[model samples]
Target: MKKIVLLLFFLAVIAQTAFAQVKKPTLMVIPADAWCMNNDYMTTYSAQGITMNVPDYKLALQNDIDLLNVITKIGELMAERGFPLKDLSSTIRSLEQSSAENEMLMSATSGASLAETPYEKLMSRAKADILIELVWKINTVGPKRSVTYTLRGLDAYTNKQIAAATGTGAPSISAETPVLLEEAVLSNMDNFASQLQMYFDDLQTNGREVSVEILTFDNGSGVNLESEFDGEMLTDIIDTWMYNHTVEHRYSVSDATENRMLLEQVRIPLFRENGMPMDTRNFVNNLRRDLRKAPYNIECKLLTKGLGKAVLVLGEK
Candidate 1:
């Protein structure tokens, strides 16, 4: 009878402990750009004297089995910590579908270019709050090997490196590549994941950071940034709009010129009122709408360089 009572008491404690731990900030893991190049998962493009090499996750998915094994093991570790893993392939397929739909309907109707780079599409569809990047190399020395690794945790909304860890694994048998990689990750991942979570918690209380820029065309027209609207210069108007729209009026003007205005450290709510994630693209669209109305009534083009930097072109694209 005492044994039965003790077992029930321990089970209740276990249940309470499990229920007390809640996870936040969904995560997606992918190989680092440099790591892919070293492993031959690369694609190159050249326009002038410059050559650009980008990671080919698709090719890596198909060809790099050993790297995939390490990635899978790392994901398993994330899962053990109660962090949900977003699948990259599934995100890609969803993005492809949404891109096609946007092109077919919205682009055709509005006559706007719906062409998005693969990276942007993935960013839109992944639904991940943080991106965990893994870069690693395995070196074989005679019968044993070691793995040197770097892991970076980036905020999905801000593209900031909130957490990073690097280390070299202890030597082990040459064939123990996966095991060595696991140990290397395990040694630092708990702290890395905690840092990622802590960043989101901080962002929740204090808003996410974003940068905005205003520029005009270099055409012969005299459209200067100093031009005034309703007695306020274009730069001042932009500042007022930012102050009115941003969270708690938290933003700073780094530089202003007759042709350009740079606004940095703009704080935005983690989620929009509609419960959607707030990103630079969406936030700038609202700014565009406002700028197209009222005294300013400026017709401008909004371009986002990834998830955090947004540029508003005053005169032309």
Candidate 2:
């Protein structure tokens, strides 16, 4: 009888170990080259009729460098998260030439061709369950400069689009125009990569079908506003609350009373059921009240007044 009981306990331990060994799906990230150009296909129809002639090679090379940086960063981030990076060097090497061409031509331009040369293309043929496409564009709008980035993930086998995200950022207009543009691109690159990783992680855990939003308000008075409670916030709240009723993620307080600050939006997945508590409302409320009382010490302040308002305004189906 004693031997039988010991055998049963050993079997149970082996079963638990097997269950814990279940591997998560691997995500494949395909970093594509950027297509930056002074003249897009639309340049063909301008009143000047594509008078600006710039070499497409420079733009393509710049984009390639930028994309490589993003890929390296993402690889580092994923390795830190314990996810395997599928070998992509062969696929990247196969992409000898990628170009973008304007398919449409305006008739009004007549013989004055406002057409842009087909930009190089960056294609990825990786065989993996998940894939990511990162595209960026640099633009100089008069005195202001900006960069637009697009991030998309698709199922490698099915070719179905899983997630898509877009972000744009600009630099302050100043005498150091070139420096500001570089800074803007670098900053936007980090933001784009971070968001892409978050979305990819969600898709890997949950089904590919999920939606998330992140909203930030920067009032000059240093007050930051978030709409719905997020995992990052909840994690901090939990760690702090579990130890002591305190807040952990605090934004700067603003002195401007005129509401000069505006709100920005970000999207995220709903849930993953990965150790996070299902009920977060009470936790949020308690955290908020604690912050109000001890605002100076807490790292974050939960804006109870604005949470409901944000839900009412930005609720999704």
Candidate 3:
């Protein structure tokens, strides 16, 4: 009997340790300022030559629904990713109520409004090691429409921004704006969570130190070509370079080339032409070379050492 009791205690201890090792708490805060637009133009439509205005209370109710959806989706994603969801539903409900009150108060005043409200207070009350703030915006330019969102993670106690992610979703002026918003939020949830996880992993492995470097370059073709590269050109370049060199070559079925040769022959020339000092003729030649070598394979490394991360942006020479 004594041996059996000891065995049972040991098993219980092991179980507790395993559980503790897997359990992590995270808090997600979506402020009202994160909403796509300060003005809900959808509520300002006119029908039959009579302008129809949405009541503040009604708008508040709708805002609560939107907030609830965002919070629920985030909580679900976190739970799926091995984070404890403890009391998330209740927390979401509380946030919804707070959001409703804030929207109501803001509806009354056009210019002057409360600096801080119950909603902000409640969000501030959420306690966790990591906190994520989600902000979204909707913009219309001519006939083009765009939706943008940003996810920022911060240390709860220190209030220091740890990690951030930004992504844009397809935009349309159709009646499905709300549905589009939900889809965009859900689509980016994994990325947002992954960034937070990376931050936490860094904190455990290294200290609190992170760095970012932005290297802007012309396409290296000196033809004065006019083409829209959008804002993802840098990421596209890095991804293509990494895929060809390091990732499996199943896509193109090619053996890995020497890193140094690839860097000098293709990558260095690009930087030298666009980033380094050079004469106009040399710049145009370099640009022409890069343009002619479109779809070239390049390789680069994103090295993170002891909280210092650097993206050694490389291109085909």
Candidate 4:
């Protein structure tokens, strides 16, 4: 009996250790845009003579006590299930610091400034694999209050919704908002987590989805997609490279022209050959390097937007 008990204890310990070794996707919780708009936490920006409203995450985090409490509770619950969260406030602060530093630096050769859009700053700084958007409403009926909550898991790379859960909690006369929010999510958390796992599993199998566009600088280099190299059109060479480099030749040439080419649904490997995490910039830069070699002998400039889109301009930097 003593020997059987000791063997069982060792097996249990091994099982727990294995479970802990399993990798979980990194996640971050943010108030959904609807929640931000409804709560009056929004800011506007002008781009190309058009004004757009976007969620003011920094303002929301600083001003809303209930929002902080709800995010904390949800993060704690996720951490218990092996998925810890990237805190939004901390990421925002870090982004601000980096932005300030970038503003003070310029290229030594051209004296050009760092050009980054606000969206790029946020997405690059967050660095989470998944963004969990949370929205909740306090419903009061005759002094009894309940919370109607929605949680959506979005792939940070593709901005696609992979999982969602929505429901209302049982009404309570005295329970606080955080307690109600916790109760609402607890019932659906398991299924929501399962969906997230399914999405991650699909990523492991199919690779990450992104978009790549090929363009040319109008700098009179006499280079375009039709420009021939080694008896093959430049477009064909680029297409062949994409077929060979992308995961399993999974990408589509949505549009191709003399001056521009757009490739969508481009599936790239999750990691590079050296086992480092791969992003849009790294993936496109590989192509840029390849094009610079041997018969191609092309100089290319790479630009990336957010985490999933890259534009490569050929013929000159």
lDDT by residue (tens digit), candidate 3, 145-189: 665767677765345777776777776666244455555666766
lDDT for 91 in candidate 3 is 55
- Mark the regions of model 4 whose C-alpha exceeds 4 Å error after superposition: 1-22, 105-117
Q: 238, model 1: CA deviation in Å?
A: 1.6
Which is the leading candidate under TM-score?
4
| Pairs that collide, model 4 | none
The best candidate in terms of lDDT: 4
Worst 10 residues of 3 by lDDT: 261-270
lDDT of 4 by residue, 125-212 (tens): 8878899999999999998999999999999988999999999999999999999999989999989988988887777678889999
- Please report the TM-score between candidate 1 and the true structure: 0.78
Model 3 TM-score relative to the real fold: 0.37
Judging by lDDT, tell me the better candidate of 3 and 4. 4
Please say which candidate is ahead in TM-score: 1 or 4.
4
Q: Candidate 1 lDDT (Cα, whole model)?
A: 0.79
lDDT of 1 at 267: 89
Query: Candidate 2: misplaced stretches above 4 Å?
Result: 1-24, 31-63, 77-82, 90-126, 142-144, 172-317
TM-score of 4: 0.90
* lDDT of prediction 3: 0.45
Q: What's the true lDDT of residue 288 in model 3? A: 33
